[model samples]
Target: MEGPIEIRGLTKVYGGGFKAVDDLNFVVPKNAFMGFLGPNGAGKTTSIKIITNMLSATSGEAIINGINVMSDPKMALADVGAVVETPEFYPYLTPMETLLYLGSLRGMTNTEITNRGRDLLDMVKLTEWKDQRVGKFSKGMKQRLAIAQALLPQPSVIILDEPTSGLDPRGMVEVRDILKELRKIDVSVLMSSHLLNEVQEVCTDVTLINRGKMLRSGSVASLLNEVKAHKIEVRVLSPPALEVTNQLRSFPGVKEINYMSDVVFNVDFEGAEAEQAGLLLQLQGMGLKVVSFKESGLALESLYMSLIMESR
Candidate 1:
């Protein structure tokens, strides 16, 4: 199978010397559900805009299914669909009417339009509201309608920006399931979201960025395991006295120490449990209140923070 998306050194610069993207590179294998993650203003929307041929990039290249997006936008977009930040619709139009309207733009026949609309509304669990005016619908309802329209073209690639926005927990799960169902039919997905938990629940591979620079990009499992350097948090009862941290700081493999709250301290180690034990003993010897200790799992929030801090 051909690669669904290929990007290399994708960069975008605006007026006033502002750069929205900088040397960003990634790929979404054909039929793969790839997550695009980043904090606000991390150039995600800008990158997406360039990919869809909505905006021209200042440099670099991207191809979808063997067609360069910049070289032949029509052919490149023939099999691609996207739902940018906020999906729009005709206020007075029904869900079915909205989808059929979009289908007309794609040159779908009336029969094809009606058939596809019914099938998609059913797929999105909005069959019951197909004839209802979209203006009266809730956010989730509107999103479902937008999805129906987005799929009317039968595109191979579906790029969604913040699919879970305006959705409650159950609605979010529904959208996630919709994406999963798309994967089963070999649809390539490129989704962008800052909701780490949602991405963790749905995406297989990811590219995370901050300040317009790629922080980490790969399988979620590998990225989570990237910080293998062991880190632990400890709580003490008799809090260490002044200058007491200096003694433990001299121990081998102790990278750094941080006091979180008055009684808790975080220790960075180089995977030496023996050295950690020795250090703990030294702290205990100081007659400090040794309360509890636990391993700290690397969280997405922490990973994001580390990326932002490293950028600074």
Candidate 2:
């Protein structure tokens, strides 16, 4: 059997019936690099804890493989490796110590633990600093150490919470690469990130949630395809906003216009890119100042914002 992830009626409630996750449902096919996305306070972390058996869910059920998380927390965790909410480790523990400690908790013998821990450290590029106390490590270095420790159990499923939250550009690349390597080893990954570009970089599929409810779930390509809308950028030499907007409203393909900045506007188009030239010509013919015009690809940030706004 593969590392299929299943969630059924997963719900979580806090004090006074504040539902953290409400009736969420989805499945990440085996070996999937699934992105779990939501804004802050959207219950991403709470849901992850329940799935990993760290916190008992208020109700509902979840399973990885055939392991019932609520009924068999130990066995359910046997093949799951997770770095949740900024990984925690003893400040006195070195990278090596952290992995060894995790290995022991997983019930591996010392020899087996040492061998696997070394390999993981090497894989995460932490071999040189394995003996150094984690307290002395940089943020990126500590994050790498967390990854190494997560792999010590040779888990089939890996979950990372905001894995790139506080990372620099280079640190982000390191964490992304580590995720890619995990796929090579056939480990399924479930990652939560508010960074749209970061999630777009590594996730094949995604499940978006808001206010404790599942909002969307599907392949990235499929999700994008669902949005048939296109956008174009128009830069006028020197034009007035209302006049230009009114003029654009009469164009064949233009649906709406969004002012990007001074002298820049993004025109939403219902037609194709080939029609953009005609639209610009129409502007010029109307005696409106025209400096530059070009087509713009849909931005994930824009897409997410639009979706969320429309939902409300």
Candidate 3:
């Protein structure tokens, strides 16, 4: 019943009065896929370093599940798996051997290591390459292996920093697919990323930060729904005529319309729920077969850009 992560005034400062993280506070609930969002130099990496004990906080406390990381790091991190950045592997070692070594370091017995390692390799879709040298694997493959290693202990909370930072389109897709699977297993995850689309696709909740400060935090759906005005994409069954396009503009509550194609258009509208419903009905009454209507704006991107500008 406990939340997986909590922070109170987590501040980090360097020698010359550079505050990397400033009075940050947030809590990630149990099994929450929380996206820690920010631009470069926004203290995301610095905060993660403090949580994993890579660096000491200038002030404040970070608690993981019920253990205070600052006071009892060993116990606090016992059930936590973190990948702060790109993890390197012994190129000569195979996936099986690599995991065996890592497991031995964690005091896992031979039987436990073998069994768990096998399962982890399978989970990361590397079962076929278990005996293959890691040196032959691509960057995406290595990243997957890193993730499997992070889950070796079956940790309750997983912390990832820029998990898909640099990779080909295919690699990025593969990693994101794996991240989506984590939610099905009920693992709490905190992934940091500056990419809005990536976070929007993979995270259910988000905490946006800028210049080492918290800007907003909430559920993705709720945040998107909170926007007062929206750019809506509408697709009709047939090519819309000039008169039909003109009719779209004259619709109540529609501020403007941009023609995207014969059958598609984007409408900027400011309206309440009831008004929107009425507008849709009016469009249908105009003899246009509506195929789809949905918000076209990327709400997270909009929010992130606005907050960053305000912080400046």
Global lDDT of each candidate:
0.80, 0.81, 0.86
Give me the overall lDDT of model 3: 0.86
Give each model a TM-score.
0.79, 0.87, 0.81
- In terms of lDDT, the best-performing candidate is 3
Q: Order candidates by TM-score, high to low.
A: 2, 3, 1
Question: Can you write out model 3's per-residue Cα lDDT over 170-209, one digit (the tens) per residue?
Answer: 8888889888988887688999999899999999889888
By TM-score, how accurate is candidate 2? Answer: 0.87
Tens-digit per-residue lDDT, 132-213, candidate 2: 8888788888888888877788888888888888899999899889887766778788899888887777888888888878
**Any idea what lDDT model 1 has?**
0.80
- In angstroms, the error of model 1 at 220 is 2.1
In candidate 1 the C-alpha lDDT for residue 26 amounts to: 85
* Residue 229 shift from truth in candidate 3, angstroms: 4.3
